[model samples]
Target: TGVSKGAMLSHKNVVSNVLQASGAYSPTLDDGAEFVVTALPLYHIFALTVNCLLFLHKGSKNLLITNPRDIPAFVGELRKYPFTVLTG
Candidate 1:
């Protein structure tokens, strides 16, 4: 949402804390879409809020990459999947 840590945290809590049951109803991940992640850690509030929570809620596969310095590799990874959304 916002650049400041406070704004980030605020949005994270409000956006990520979704209610979903854990059972066979567990949704599928990455049905078919464009989701690219470059150096975004799941632990971070930004990624956790937009990437982890939203994807899981929508049942999308999360291609977690800790290191995104290598642009070529990142592009390659991006090319491999059909993601609907690419987050930072």
Candidate 2:
């Protein structure tokens, strides 16, 4: 058995964070033409908000790495795409 604790965030919190990120990053339509490669797991808040949500908001493509430990495969996958941004 295990113990667990949970926290909840309202829609406004999410939207506010997204908006703040957009303002900070200043992503434009040109970003939509690029791709974002993320080694961090999307289950984590930072990756979820910045790598996935932020790019999605900018209309950019997201290439998620299911297993970043596989060095060869990871490099191969990155080479396969003209990735513009890499986040770990």
Q: Pick the candidate with the highest TM-score.
A: 2
Residue-level lDDT tens digits of model 2 in 1-88:
6898666978888888987988888744355776899999887888988898888988899898899999999999988999888876
TM-scores of all candidate predictions against the true structure = 0.56, 0.84
Residue-wise C-alpha lDDT for candidate 1, range 22-83, written one tens digit per residue: 22223533433435453587777567655776666656667876678878988888788776
Clashes of each: 11, 0
Model 1 residue 86 lDDT? 66
- Candidate 2: give the clashing pairs: none
Off by over 4 Å in 2: 1-6, 27-29
The runs of at least 3 residues in candidate 1 whose Cα sits more than 4 Å from the true structure, single-residue gaps closed, are 1-38
Candidate 1 weakest lDDT stretch, 10 residues = 20-29
- lDDT scores in order: 0.59, 0.85
